[model samples]
Target: MFHKILIANRGEIALRVLRAAKELGIQTVAVHSTADAEAMHVRLADESVCIGPPPSRDSYLNIHQIVAACEITGADAVHPGYGFLSENAKFADILDAHNITFIGPRADHIRVMGDKIEAKRTAKRLGIPVVPGSDGAVTEDAEAKRIAAEIGYPVIIKASAGGGGRGMKVARNEDDIDVALATARSEAGAAFGDDAVYIEKYLEKPRHIEVQVVGDGDGRAVHLGERDCSLQRRHQKVWEEANSPALNAADRSRIGMTVANAMADLKYAGAGTIEFLYENGEFYFIEMNTRLQVEHPVTEAITGIDLVHEQIRVASGAGLSVEQKDVQFNGHAIECRINAEDPKTFAPSPGTVSHFHTPGGLGVRVDSAVFSGYKIPPYYDSLIGKLIVHGSNRVECMMRLRRALGEFVVDGIKTTLPLFQDLVNSRDIANGDYDIHWLEKYLAKADT
Candidate 1:
């Protein structure tokens, strides 16, 4: 076990890692930007160092400053808690060269899975179902048109390096292909510095389901089941539930085993998620997220497992604490992403929180970094907290989530509280009959 570790990010995730390390008798050093000198994570960590300015390029995303902080603090390992450099292969290699442990997968694994084109090919070779589209990247408009025509109409152009729905566009016909391809490449270049784009058949109103799998280094892997993340806006997930309402028990097992087999075949380690798109009872591989997802808490709620601790154990050469048969998914869990944004226009709202009142009761868990008088910064994501609820079944879970959302109170800034309140109360959500476009349609009705 590592005696000390450095956390290379900020916000609630940093605090989440800190709490876990402390429980395992490990000292934690937090590295923060100048904008987060007095942040909640910094206050809770055993020690802290200011890295750089507010801008992410000079601060959170700056690799050198984070490595220097680790050296200065004598940290034996670095735990990158999602985002920033968490999925950067070069950062993992740098830590390896410095003889410091990275509490995640191997650098090679990150490199292989980080590339969307390569991941799909690998999944196909492993016998996993993938959407029909271009074999790889399309460098010319002629090739793009050929691929789009072959795949039929209603195809999507996506960046080879893109995630979170950025650098993606849907073309319904041949006439729209040229503009869609050009726009996607430009956006990809701006966001990821790589303009490479690929084509795939777009499945309208698909359910975004992902399976969480953990590898125990020795080639053993198991799936903790799936998360239903179809409820999203701007390609960002807002609500996630465990044991997808769309999939039956047999199909769930099939998808889970398929993902586990793929991971074992690739020699993957630590924790990763194999995401898929479900449409008309068929599942197609989308991409794999190589780090802990923003929605992992819902899985933990049903499994009673500490994923952070398991990541550390795997990094330290330990095996997974549970096996496939030993893992049992019970009850239903739901999570609402509480963001600092306007419910109407969806604009970012960052400011000091005048008052904070969180819900507490059976099956309600809040993962947050804010408290009374805490100032929310504008330098990063708008996520202020996560409101999670669990119940014996889906119906109870929905009711519990509704009650919890009502109890949550944050003042002095706008939030998406009202949006979720209206969503959970809707009959569509109550019956689990919503598709990816349900929220958009719901909002349109409110406009009148």
Candidate 2:
């Protein structure tokens, strides 16, 4: 086991990793930017280091400064709690060269899975189902048009190295294809410095389902069930639930085993999510997240597994603690990503939190690092917390989530709490009869 682990991110996820380390009796070093001088994770860590200024490029993303922090603190491992450097293969390789451990997958795995184009190829090669798309990036407009025609109309153009909905454009037919391809390539260049784009058949309506798996880097892995993240806005997941309400017992087992088997073959290390778009009783792979997901709590709630703990254990050369046969899924769980944003406009809300209150009771968990008087800096993501609720079944879980959302309060800044409240009362959300486009349509209708 590592004696000390340095957390390489901030906000709720940083705090989440710190708690997990503390539980395992591992000393922790928290690295922070000047903007996060008073962050909760820094306050609670065994040691803290100020790396740089507020800008992410100068601070959180600065690899040299982070390595220096590790050296100074004698930290042997780094747990990048998502975002920033979490999926950067270069960062992982640098740590490896310095004899410091990265508590995630191998650098090669990250490198391959980080690129959407290569990830799709790898997924298909691994016997995982993937969306029908161009064999690789289409560099010319003629090729793009040809691929779209071959795949039929209503194709989507996506950046080879894109995420968070950026560098993506959909074309309903031939007339829209040229504009979609040009816009997608332009956005891809601006956002990712890569002008490469690919075409894929776009499903009119699909439920976003993802299987969670953890591997020990020794061809041993296990799946912990699946999460339905169909409720999204602008491609960002707003709400997620475990044991997807859209899938039955057979569907769950089939997909879960398939993902686990593939990870085992790949010798994937630590925690990873194989995301898919489910439609017409089939699953099509989208991409793979090489690190822990923001919505992981819901999976943890259902599986009785501590992902962070398992991540640390596996990274330390310890094989998987639980086997495939031993893994069990129980209950239904949901997670609401509470962001500091306007409920209606969804604009970022950054300010001092005057008063704060978290929902409580059986099966309700709030993962947040903010407190009353905490200043939500404008330099970071708007997500302030996650409210996760678990119950014996989906109905009970929805009821519990509704009650918990009502109890959640954060003052002196706008939040999306009201949005979640309205969603909980909606018939579509109540019945889990929503798809990837449902939230956007709902919001649009509300605007009209």
Candidate 3:
């Protein structure tokens, strides 16, 4: 076991990792920007260090400063809690060179899975189902058009290194393929500094599903279950639930086992999520996140497994603690990502929180680091917290989530609480009749 672990991120996730480390009797070192000196994670850590100023490039993303902090604090391991340097293969390699363990997958795996084209190839090679499209990057307009025609029209152009909905465009027919390809390539180059693009057959209405798996990097892994993140806006997940209301017992077992077997074969280490798009009883691989996901609480709520704890254990060379059969799924669980933003316009709301009140009771959990006087930094993400609820069934879970959302309050700044409150009461959401495009359409309809 590591005597001290340094957390390389901020906000709720950093606090989440700190708590888990404490539970395992591991001392934690919290690294923060000057803007986050008073952050909750810094306050709770055994030690704290200021990396740099507010800007992420100068602070959170500075590899040299982070490595220096680790050396100074004598932290033997680093747990990058998503975002920033979490998926940076070079960062993982640097840590390895310094004899500091990275509490995640191998650098090679991160490198392979970070690129869309390579990830698709790897997924297909691993026997995971994938969407039909070009074999590799579609460089020329002619190739893009050819792939679109072969895939039957309604193809989507995506950046080979894109995510979060950027660098993606859909063409309904051959006439729209040229503009879509040009636009996707331009956006990809601007966002990721890579002009490479690929084509995939676009699905009209698909549920966004992801399987959660943890491996010990030794041909041992277990799939906790799956989460349905179909409710999204601008490609960002707004709400997520476990055991997917759209899937049944057989569907769940099939997908879950498939992902687990793939991870075991690849010898993947730590926590990773294999994302897919589900349509008409079929699952198509999209991408793989080599780090803990933002919506992991819902999976934890259902499986009763402390993922962070397991991550630390596996990274320390202590193989998986639980076997595949021992992993049991409980009732339904849902997570609402409460961002510090306007409910209507969806603008960023970063300001001092005058009053903060979180909901309580059974089957309700709020993961946040903000307090009454905490000032939400404008330089970082606007997500202030996550509200996760679990119950004996989906109906009970929704009811509990509704009650919890009503009780959640944060004053002196706008929040998306009202949006969740409205979603909980909607008929479509209630019936679980929603897809990847559902939230965007719902928002558009509500505007008019």
Candidate 4:
């Protein structure tokens, strides 16, 4: 293991990595912007450095400043919790240039998985099922129209390098395809600097499921389990659960093995997630997240595995501690993302917390960075914390989550707590019979 590691992100995830490193007897260094000088992760780390000002471009996203901080702190390794530069292939190359260990997958692996179109092609070569889409990227309006007609109506135009619902559009007819294609391509170029867009048949009421796999740098890989993140808003996951009600034992085994085999063949390292869209008992490959997912806590709750530790061990040239047979799924786990946002208007509400109270007791976990007098900065993500609950069964997990949400209290800021509460109590969520659009439709009927 490295003598010391630098965490390249902020908020609860940074804190999460710190806890794991501490448990493994690894020293930690935190890099923060001036805006997050007093952040919880900074306070917990053995050493902290201010990379730059509040702007992400000059701070969290600035490679030079981060490299400088690592060198200054003498951190031999860097762990990017998630988001920001976690999946940036060039950043990984830079770390390689400096001879600093990047505690994630290799740069080449990231590059292949980062491009949606390329990932699809790779999946096909591996015999993994993929949603029928256009052959590579469409360069002309006429070509996009041809692909759309072949795929039939209600197709989705997605950016080759896009995620979080950006650079995506649904076109139900020929007239809409041209305009949607053009707009999607433009937005894709602006958001991800990739104007290459692909077309695919859009599934109505699809369930988003992903398998978590941890590989030992030496071609050995094992899957933890699958997470159902179907409950989303604008394609961004809002709620996630493990042991998806949508999948069966055989289904899980098949997908899990397929992902692990693919990684093993590619000699992929560390942790990554293979995301898929499931509908009508079939799974379609979407993309692979090359870093720890925001919903990882839920997977950990059910599997009793510390993904961070596994990541560290993998990076250190140690093999995975557990094998396929040793991996067992015990219970149902759920995670609700509590963001500092107006429940009615759905806008960010950044401010100081007058009072902060988190739920406690069995099977309830709160991963947050806020406390009394802590001010939420508007320069980054609005997520304040994650409310995760586990139980022997799905029903019990749901009940505990509802109770836990009620117990959480963060004053002087608007939160989606109320909105999540309404969701847990809804009939669709209770029966676990809803799809990705469930949350959007639920909010649409609200008096707001």
lDDT per residue as tens, model 3, 1-448 = 9999999999999999999999999999999999999999999999999999999999999999999999999999999999999999999999999999999999999999999999999999999999999999998888888888898878999999999999999999888988999999999999999989999999999999999999999998899999999999999999999989999989999999999999999999999999999999999999999999999999899989999999999999988889999999999999999999999999999999999999999999999999999999999999999999999999999999999998998999999999999999999999999999999999999999
- Ten residues in a row with the worst lDDT in model 4? 439-448
lDDT of 1: 0.91
Model 3 per-residue lDDT at 145: 88
TM-score for each predicted model, relative to the true structure: 0.98, 0.99, 0.99, 0.98
Clashes per candidate, residues 3 or more apart or on different chains? 0, 0, 0, 0
Where is model 2 more than 4 Å wrong at Cα? none
Worst 10 residues of 1 by lDDT: 434-443
Which stretches in model 1 have alpha-carbon errors above 4 Å? none
Scanning candidate 3 in windows of ten residues, the lowest lDDT window is 144-153
- Tell me the whole-model lDDT of each prediction, alpha carbons only: 0.91, 0.95, 0.96, 0.92
Model 2: clashing residue pairs?
none
Native-to-model Cα distance after best TM-score fit, residue 293 in candidate 2, in Å? 0.2
By lDDT, who's the top model here? 3
Rate residue 437 of model 3 by lDDT: 96
**Residue 282, model 2: Cα distance from true site in angstroms:** 0.4
Candidate 4 local lDDT, 298-346, one digit each (tens): 9999999999999999988776889989999999999999999998888
Judged by TM-score relative to the true structure, which candidate is superior, 3 or 4?
A: 3
Error of 2 at 365 (Å): 0.3
